[model samples]
Target: MSNKKQKMDPRVMRTRQLLRDALVELIDERGYEKITVQDITERATLNRATFYLHYSDKLDLLYQSTKEILNDLLNNLNVTFEDKVEFDFSKDADEPHDTFMHLFEQISLNSKLYKVFLTEKDIPYFFSGLKKIIIDFISNGINFTQPDDKKLTVPRELAVRYFAAAFLEVIVWWLENDMPYSPKFMATQLMRITVKGPYLEHPFGK
Candidate 1:
């Protein structure tokens, strides 16, 4: 698939951005369940007709806005973890944001939107798709890193699920706690997990 993202018309982009920002702010103030199309349009200073012109409903608006950011993140990332190394764990946010930084940076930039989506996760595709990205990456990395001669103690599917879910929970925790760390700090931690894992030894003899 072509990685080049199609350019959005500036007017359309601005309208959508207004709607998205309004939705996130309203959601943060109230909650998704209590929000309405009229409420969003009023907050955005756009008419209800404009909202309908752009979206079928409030849910559609939420989906499109979140999807747009997610797609942008995936496109910019283009991360091929093929034989990647971890020599730069101590790197700070001043460095160029490539690879892992792209992921965390996107999250940091859209914290309000994400915090709302993550907490109101029942709306569908809002949170699960985000988790799936992590799952897929961890799966691909494990497959690439494993040696042919050595068998994994845990099933590959189980390993992928555990890591993906744990990583997502970490993200949720970060946002919930007001993101005390920077994007680079979060990215560094993800790299550490990707490389060395938690290293939790078994309480009982294997």
Candidate 2:
């Protein structure tokens, strides 16, 4: 009764990768709403039956593709979190927090796909799913124990939501503007705002 997902066969994995790539290309060229299963299959050089064997519809394909990317982002963050190193925002901007930098790098690497999904494709669920992932990750990483002198004005859940929403907006803006800044710079900016700014300070006073 392990909840882990079973490993997919190599051939199956390749096929799915093809389908996912095909979908992203199609969505980029013709937007998501106009895309049909035939378009994906044709682009993938795959048959309708083969596509159906893996995904029920284009939406399913989109969800699975996005989920895979988000899972990778979460995994990268988790690795840095596991290191148990405290993030020092005062350090040189060239040396941002590892977890944030890694997450931003993942987004930058998949910038094209994210651009299509977040802005061009008209997928509301993408944002919703992304928010949920961010919230879950932050919630798990938060330390519930605080010193006796500090008091929290806002609920822990509210703070998580606030930060997650703000982070999502920043990501959308960055992708929309073609990422004017480097991932390291963007990550550093985010860390500064979240850690050193008044938002966290006013509510979670030390």
Candidate 3:
């Protein structure tokens, strides 16, 4: 963050948080379409100008807060991965499974925010964020591989899109079904299918 954003006062932070909380609550009670900037301000006990200073509109606030949630998720993942002493996936796959479950747990803890993300009104931003993360991961992974043929191939982008789409679909299904399965179990099953490439022909081929 820049100095401008970092230099906010504690009071200002409190007010912003209040507005965000109020907005989520309002959306839960009613719906995003029916909620207005005035409603958020009134619920937060803040002025319209204050709301404007923080956000141009409700969607902007939603995007900003969701980004924060993503950043926190990434930070927690980094912490989990960094603390590991060994990095053997076949032998130490449980760590990744646990990490993924932790991510699900984080999302579950904030079901309201995720409910908004799963909704048609706000799903685009969530998918966009997921796409960006998958793109970066696949890009870096491809960069580390030496091409076998004369031409340079970058099919990892396609692979990333495929994987992210599948992942998002699974998440949306879980959310829509009220997440009957625990995150740990869901992560275990997904990790198996992903790492093992299914039980049949092997997705990546031997």
Candidate 4:
């Protein structure tokens, strides 16, 4: 596993990128379930044998592609928060934090693939992978031990799940609506919601 983290040969990396791009294009053109290994290799302009060198089958390609996407997200977050003492949302309006902006930018960059995956694909594996990534990110960044006056009433895990689910739904909605809002604006809105606690006052009575 450690060896896998080492830099890969440029030629090999280029080949894998081509294959991944081809898969994304094909998935967007048709659906993932309808695609085959031959279709991927043909679209990638690589031989079946070459495709086999990197992935066992179309499913293997899907798994590897999903893993790469999640890793990209995690890496961006790690780099953005590496030296920070706390999450900062007060940066200049034009200069949004990479940690927050990267998520929206990535989705925008790969909007076609994401739209297909979130709506057309029946794979639960992708959602599970994404949820785990979000949970890990929140778990690492947050101090679970609350201050005496602001104690959390819910379990840490439940809070994480609630936040993650809500965020995911927001992403889906944004994509479905063609992302009318800019990434910076979307990120700022999310930060605002997170920083401001939910309103709990009853409209009818105390």
Candidate 5:
């Protein structure tokens, strides 16, 4: 997908946006468990019939809203990320940095939705969906180095999951801490780990 969102019908988009905004605000005020479909419809100023046309229940509404945000993240990434491409680590950091910069910026834009998704206990389903998306995206995009001269200590799948989980937890930490560092700084830190291993070299080897 392109970085720009596709044109959505104004009326349908407006209705969904109202519903999504209502859900977010209600989650903040009364918490997810306390919220009802009625509360969402009322807050959105739409009737139950209209809400039902778009969603089945409050959980459905919340789930769909979270999904829309995730889709927006993909669009915000601003590159043809789905296609497999060779990632040359020998090159300057700018290549990786640009990708992460777009990512971190998108996360910052949707920080509220992410904060709610990461922190809320009622949305394990949503969280799992989010995790799967990340894992798939990472697995698709990254071309991990493999050579005849080397053997990995762990399986590639394990390593990918580790990276995906760590990436998510880092985002959660940044959001929880109100993003103490700029996106570029965080991207730099992550890039350092990605291009080089996370620790210092032994025996002064490069």
Candidate 6:
């Protein structure tokens, strides 16, 4: 992050934003199938060379935009819980709930980018990136003590997968309905169900 890069000229930033905005607008208006690099460049008032300089292809641009948005979220986040937060269908913390709301606020602000990422063909890796974020957060937040407890039967992997899948489902639903509910409301709803699970006991607690 050089000073020059950080303080990119307003013109350059404006061009980049134009390119992204153009692509998103095109995708919304006509869908990805009918969109082309030339369409995006023409809409942005930039040439093909400029489009290439910013992104490799439409798919690349889509994913890059998503990655940039997610990076912005992860870098700015501050999730705090009181204890070893198990990656389970349990919800208990106000702070983590607040943090999730913040993340979704970021997501809501860029819903078009998300819709394109989710519905676009040949982009399972986008979901994988979302999973990785949850897994990484859970792994880092929960400290295991055993020397060989990498597989401590905490069901960490499955839990991470569950959270990712469930959360994404909510997000997709939100996008489909044009996000009628606030992000915080949706997140709090999720947290209540998820965090309440671990406290309940079954016959074998399975």
**Top-TM-score structure, candidate number:** 1
Better of 1 and 6 by lDDT: 1
**lDDT by residue (tens digit), candidate 4, 1-206:** 22564668878988998898888888878878788999989998999999999998888888888887767666656543555545454443334455667777777876766666777655677777777877765554344224233576777767778878877888888988988898878876765565454444645687
Ranking by TM-score: 1, 5, 4, 2, 6, 3
Q: Name the runs in model 4 displaced over 4 angstroms.
A: 1-6, 79-82, 86-98, 144-150, 197-206
lDDT for each residue of candidate 3 in 39-80, tens digit (9 for 90 to 100): 988998888998998899988887787777677565555434
lDDT of 1 by residue, 8-28 (tens): 667887898999999999888
Off by over 4 Å in 3: 1-10, 45-53, 79-85, 94-102, 137-155, 198-206
Candidate 4's error at 201, in angstroms? 11
lDDT of each: 0.76, 0.77, 0.67, 0.72, 0.75, 0.68
Top lDDT prediction, candidate number: 2
**Each prediction's number of clashing residue pairs:** 0, 0, 0, 0, 0, 6
lDDT of 5: 0.75
* Candidate order by decreasing lDDT: 2, 1, 5, 4, 6, 3
Worst 10 residues of 3 by lDDT: 141-150
Candidate 2 global TM-score: 0.76
Query: Per-residue alpha-carbon lDDT of model 5 for 41-153, expressed as tens digits?
Result: 99999999999988999888887787778777766655644332455555654446456777788888877778877788877776787688678656654533443223656
Clashing pairs in 2: none
Write the residue-wise lDDT of candidate 6 on 1-206 in tens digits. 23544788888778777888887788778877788999999998899998888788987777766676677656645654433345332335433455566667777878877776676664567667766776665454333322244655556656666666777787788887888888887777666655554454665756
Between prediction 2 and prediction 4, the one with superior TM-score is 4
List, residue by residue over 1-206, the lDDT tens digit for candidate 2.
Answer: 01223566778988988998898898888888898999999999999999999999998998888888777766667564446456444564346667778878988988878777887647777777778877875665444222222465677777778888888889999998999999989988887777567453477566
**Cα deviation of 39, candidate 5, in Å:** 2.1
Q: Assess candidate 1 and give its lDDT.
A: 0.76
lDDT score, candidate 3: 0.67
